[model samples]
Target: MRPNLLKRAHSHNKQTLNNLLHSRGTSPHPQPETISGHKQIEEETLPKYNPDHWYPVRLGEVLHHRYEIVVKLGFGMTATVWLARDLQADGNAGNRKYVTVKINVNTLGEEFQKGRREIAQKLFSANPKHPGYSHVRFMLDTFKVKGKHGDHLCIVYDVLREPIDLCMEKFPGRRFSCPKLRILLPALLQGLDYMHSECHVVHTDLKADNIMMGLGDPNILDHFVQNQIDHPAPRKAPDGHGRVIYTSCSDFGEPPNEAVIASAKITDIGLAAWGDEKNTKPIQSNAFMAPEVILQAGWSYPADIWNLGVMLWDLFEHFGLFDRIDTKPGHYHPEQHLGLMIALMGPPPKDFLKRCAKASIYFDSDGQFKHPEYIEDHTFESSIVRLKGEEKEMFIDFAKKMIAWVPEERWTAKQLLEHPFLTKEKEFFSATPSLSRASTASISSMIPSRAVTPGIPPSSSPNSGPNSSPKSVPNTTLLPPRLLELVPSVSSTECESSTNCEETKTEKLATNNEKSTSRTSLSLRPKMESLVESNNEPDVEVPNSKRLSVNKANKCSQDIIDAILSKGKNHNHRVSPEAK
Candidate 1:
């Protein structure tokens, strides 16, 4: 007989054997036998392999007699995710409902159990419909499965598509377009705001890997699953546990067109903590690590903002913002990282430097940086000078606010959502079929202008064309006074000069023929001494309404300056009084 015929015959024989055993009132799988207390103790003490190291469970195995293990999704440090079919699905034909099962290693003992229980309570007790929970992945149910290593804790979640890192891998470069960035940043921030404020949880770890692309349409998922069922991938050999590891056939193609890739959800809350909980272990990924975290100073929600900012830079530029190659073995150079930060953003505030435990290692007593070689002659503007259109300005401006040396100086997620860079109206999200027409329109209206111009390099000249200039389309919305202060706006002098020219253009032209060209050239100068001298000599009275706006703007600026001074003044303290 041919090999294919032989395999079919063998499968038929195995099925027949299982049927025979079922008819005889016995199970094909082995059952556990009762043992004495001494024997049980001996078994517990014996050397046992971790179930996750090898395939702990078999394909077709009924977990808790409801979810039948279908394929292995992936594995993590302490857990393994599997795609499983729900046996108890409500009377739907052909297609069965599938879920992701996360099985965590349970050999970690009592302390691990206590921590797991706390996390479970926090996750399970929360309201899923809350706005804070908007971009967060919600748990469905949990159970335990007894294995040779120990009992494994299994968590069930709605089947998500893939991680943002995986999505980036499929693209030509490991970068997403600005439109995608707009969608992704807003959703992530909304989730962060919810987690920080309503849930009172701090996700110490925020990165591309932890953020997952949401499975938008049920039909699309069903189709993907159906494809797997029709054309299954080849199975691998069984492990020591006599279980074959089956790889999932689900194809997570480049960022899928069917779903809004921006509709991402933050995952893996195992490392997360309650807002007030004190953390001993170092947190955050190396590249995204905040200065406070590096210095072992007490950090809070602001650390997360710092992480988000770095993540955003990675998303936009497809490179790590603070990534450095260490010259010394067994040690990362903090001075190099700090030096780069200082070079890009001015120097860290004196107060921020005072709190650093190893401040002398990098900075002198006078707060001047010691490592000049590590510093690059780069500012946000100089770095993004190549970028075409207003993106160069907007990106640098947005980044400056987030990558501040002082944590409190960083914009909160809520405040960042209102930024013009993110709010610019665009039709990018409209291409996603999953979003409704109304939703597409609503999102587009919030944006000030489209930031993305495909195939154009950042270094491209801003004067390429009239259409290329973002200034051609004026932003109609009046920004809040507070936001106006944060962002560099049209200077009052420029505004006054422009307004005056617009009102008196015809009158000026009529009065001057030879002087018209000279007058135009002089007026264009930003701080012409003659113009300034003339304006200063006049004692003009301002309207009360105009005076009120100016006063408010000044107050806002003063308050910001005072806050910085206050932070610097209390740098010697263990915990800043302002933090309280």
Candidate 2:
């Protein structure tokens, strides 16, 4: 009976070997030694961190038999990030690859564990060769290791130099310059656009803390890694949960250069979700929350635009746009925040107010704040006191369009990309002439019919015949030739109606210009008449009061154009005043 059992076990082992060989597309028993060597190699390549006992992670302790912990990067609620060196990197001697390792403190919750796997799968699925991938922080690898409490998840990422918040802290007053903003905003928007469109994900938490400056110099990174290794700092005492706490320290002196900051990538997408998904849970930091989010109204992509507007304001002002007041021990005054929004952006449109579930709590039926005293002592004009003439006008104009009471009215990422503020440079326009042409076309299509008065003879047009009226179009306003030059060719019919038409035309141009330039002082030139054109529909007649408002807006825009042109001359920069 013993001999029969032994023979059966031997036959089963032989059958398993045969199956393995067949799976490898090899004949059974043809390469037994090679198969045994492959198995040995596979075992060696597997992670070595013990699952039963937590490894004591000292400053110099190696992880996965590859990475050696060098420096504590930072700590969050659930994890501590560490800078580590890849000891197994290919080199003759001493040269090592640096990486950021985020170690979770405890065994992750079911939701977080699922999120981590989803993120890893999505990141791994992305093609590294795509240019869009450059804007996002890609995961290097992930593994599980035993911790003091339980098994911890360790996520590896490319070494990012610093978070934007920390980087900004080094600047004077923690404010970024317009030039720096120009560089960073575009990169950030590009990253966001890719995430929204390509990845089909919405970064529910978009803030300075989640945006990081990319690697600058490899030598500098190596130097910093070596310094950490040479001078190991003691880890702080573990918390109640027995997880070690560590403070981030940087020995690499001085803030990063503009190039590094310009390459900022969005990180910390732990709260990210599908763009179309219904997220009932609270999202985004309170200070950056959109009105839709605050009121518990349905939200989607436009919510992100609102967040961006607030972020841009913070970048320029070095403070949050919304001031939160502690009404109680743990509660914040949401109504006060709404009042502040009203004070800054004016009241929400009636349609928007109707949609807001909490509108009645904060605003009266007429759209005035229910508690006016709760409003902050601030206005758009007052907030931008630090900016000069054109800068202030451009900033306010751009912000108003984005911080609209109605989420649907906010300019989309793609539309904002073509705004004058972003395409102000001749080089930018020259490189992407199609965008400028498309923008011009879009503006021209919005030209109000009031631009062409009723009872005006066809002969009264700019291309009128020799027998045309000599009155030369009533209330004609001449736009700066430079402003006219910036606009693409409109239909002869639209151009011929009236000279005063230029005011509304230029006002619309300024609005578009303001949209892009306010974030970063991009050179924006106003396009033609559209202020009276209600919501891009030309046939609608604008009330006299609205027309007057358009006139005032045009006058202000004209002033901004003159100031911008003057500033350009002072800086010895020249932008073409020629029509494309």
Candidate 3:
């Protein structure tokens, strides 16, 4: 084995072992039992492997007699993504490029055509000059493969590294830093703007799972292919299903610090529809769904804004903005969902409700919500506890513009790009200079005037120092709050600037350096405590003057909310945090 590969494997194993033994009795759930003569591990559901469903994909199998499958990247409900090498490219093996091939399920042959056409037209025909055009994932090529069950559509795309949510795991907490969000949020909005304005498309499903990070270094792909060549992915021998099921092994390795928030592209336009396409079909995940969608009112680009707003909590706060605990298991409760919405956004507007098809069912003639008990007494400002001071204020202001109860009230993607959260760059003080002071001089005087590392202005500063501290920040994203807490206090040192020295007093923070789990647990305690306190605080009732025509939508009898709101199939195959 190559020395670097061996070292990486050793380090990975060490980390795995360490995580396994992290908290003794508190170790993660055991893996599923292996079948006889085979490792029983988590992969695609065995039941899905049928003659008329999944296309039996094999490693090294060349599709269309041109692209050779290298390894399984990921598997989803309707398709499987694989890394493939172009056999006809004009280069040697080492110099040739790779592309991701998404083979759709046989069952989706007819249903996926509209989406496929829109994806191709919107991405390819979009104005190249539109700033968001580049941020949106576009198709390189498309074709069809005839399988034994039926025909399957094959889509070829540029090999993006991983999804935004997966990238968040590299940080101490699974969240992006403010600076990183400042960089990535605009790119996402720009992409949305391009889809909405230039392409006349509305991404019905806009969440972390659909947003992927652009590949930064070409060498990462080379290493992945080399790793596969050295150690082939393990596969289950043909059993009752009579098809080999190979475990996915698509890892681009830990992204270089600069790659964190380098660029985020909106992928998976499979569920997207044209903005002018008038359809009230239920869209967006339950928690992120807009009120207009749940109420069966007409929706358009604003729905995406609402989806993005709710998703922001997941990205920055490490939790869903709306609570989703219903009596039914793996089902959506519309009443419960609406109650949460009412709490954050206050009651929906009476005028808007009048236009809703099912408004009467949820609300009385007077516009009072029928199930007022389900409502949680909270506001957007109170629900957000992680951020504080001006940062918190700016975030709430930005969110309010997107999550308005009325869809028309929501800001357009282009207008949102100019918000303070996206426009104003957050500034941070540089790491303190570790200098040895002479005599008993002030520690502040010993250190040079702290330099201001400006929040990245455009994509020009790729090699900036602040942008290179992924380990210290949230995946080259944000400065780890834990590290900021550890900044030592120097007595009597007059700081040149208040930003550098405001938090000089020693804080009574407990730290555990023994194990990662311990550190994670200890570090999260304060945040959780703060969250609990915020929840327990006295509920400030929304005054009658401010409350909208107070009403609730009656719960739909059928469970329409998609099951497993947070569940996602990742292209990059790393040990998930839950598995660890």
Candidate 4:
């Protein structure tokens, strides 16, 4: 087992609450070791674990004059979120206010555009007047600048302190309380309602991390300067001669002070979208997605409502409702990913399967979701992440309403706010200290936290779970980071060669090379095409929208129409089935 690769594997797995709850106590199982980086030492004399290669790009390095980068707040697949200061907050709310900047070098491709439409289109509440539309900005005022490569997009936003997840982590002693949940949820519901009614939007990625607190009434220019700062140029330090003194150390000086957005507005436009492919396919955080989303049924605000329910649950219960999904394929059947729903709402409605495009992998006959090849189960019994008391019941009730297999069955965000659980929060938000988040002592302690597949396996037991063991894939070699932008992914690899022969071709889809299954392309039957089909087909003329072309052909109105026909209502939705 090469220690460096092992650490990375461990870090990626940390996103799962199960790993956070119980993965540290287990012994390090030996792996197929490889040679890289430093020389191998005796097993008894391994060096300390290092977190070098992947450090957050100090906020200053990415942006220019407006704010300073304090520290990394969090990160996702394409971008890293930062907490920084805005120099123009007081006199120029028009300029620099504290902001959260999402820095992504990745091109965003289809995912970014889908999210843009979701939030730009509607709010994620049940009520016609969810407050989100009233306050949140659909598009982030942003700009772009040069990086080590050439260009990168920096999405500027009104900064907020801790995310809801961090807040829950800080508050350990309190039970998922009624008063607190009430105070918080209504504001959330109102915001969602506003977005839905005013913008016709839906935030498909509704997780604690995405919901923020800051921005009462954001000044209009809040987004304007953000655009400029994104691509700030490196300034030359006065060498007593007005000459620039370039150094390897920090670039942007006095980056803004990172803070909880004194008030937060809806952020992450890349995750919000307008159309409904059915609530079935959302590019959502695994822990918060609705069952309809998992089952491939039509979904819309209800999916966000389910996410809100989890947020409501987080107010009292520190634990996310469905944080224990097995990561490996063939562990349980795909249906089992709906464990929280099954546990709270009972068996799915009979038509649930009919709406689904059967899973590519499962743990057993019951059809629970199996882990993907890149993930592994490294849970340890001794490490326990606990959330007890009334909070548990509150979460269960919320989960029931949010994850019903039937889209219609799930509660709307507005409906959720009206529940007895959070009645008092109707008046203006009872401002809470975003900075106070949970107690540090409680958060500091927790159990810790994958890989390519060798083969696809089926389960013998209907009650089984995804294989917990790890497996290796063919290509683990690290390539130059530049490939992310310069090289076209996959198939282009063949074109890179000077020989340019048909041999050594790079395949595009799995079917091009292997008989393997993707989560979106699982046990598909011909009739299942309904999952991707749409009732109303647009004119033959193609609509012009593509952040990145899946291929000019895939962008044709007919192709999108076909996917809808095959996948059902959710096909046109911003949340693609291939959402990470």
Tens-digit lDDT string for candidate 4 (1-580):
1111122111121135644354334524222122222333212122332122112254355366675664345555455566566655575553245666666653545456455544444433334344445345443456665554445567676555344544444433433233334345555666665655455567677655565554233542344334334433222222222222111111122111112221344555565666433234545666565666666655566667667665544554444444556533245334445543454444554445555654333223454434334233321111112311222222333444454455544444544543322321111011111111111111111100012111212121111136532222111211112211121112223223312112222432222233211211111101100001111212121111111111222223343223324433321212112211
What's the TM-score of every candidate structure?
0.62, 0.64, 0.68, 0.47
Candidate 1 residue-wise lDDT, 306-327, digit = tens: 8887786666564467655353
Stretches > 4 Å off in candidate 1: 1-55, 91-96, 123-129, 169-174, 234-236, 239-250, 257-259, 326-331, 382-386, 426-580
Looking at candidate 4, the ten consecutive residues that score lowest on lDDT are 525-534
Note the Cα lDDT for every prediction shown.
0.54, 0.54, 0.59, 0.38
Model 2 alpha-carbon drift over 4 Å, by segment = 1-57, 92-96, 123-131, 229-231, 234-244, 324-331, 364-368, 425-580
List the candidate numbers ranked by TM-score, top first: 3, 2, 1, 4
lDDT rank, highest first?
3, 2, 1, 4
Q: Name the candidate, 2 or 4, with the larger lDDT value.
A: 2
Once fitted onto the true fold, the runs of candidate 3 whose alpha carbons sit more than 4 angstroms away are 1-43, 46-51, 92-96, 256-260, 326-330, 427-580
339 in model 2: Cα distance from truth in Å? 1.1
Q: Model 2: how far is 301 from its true place, Å? A: 1.9
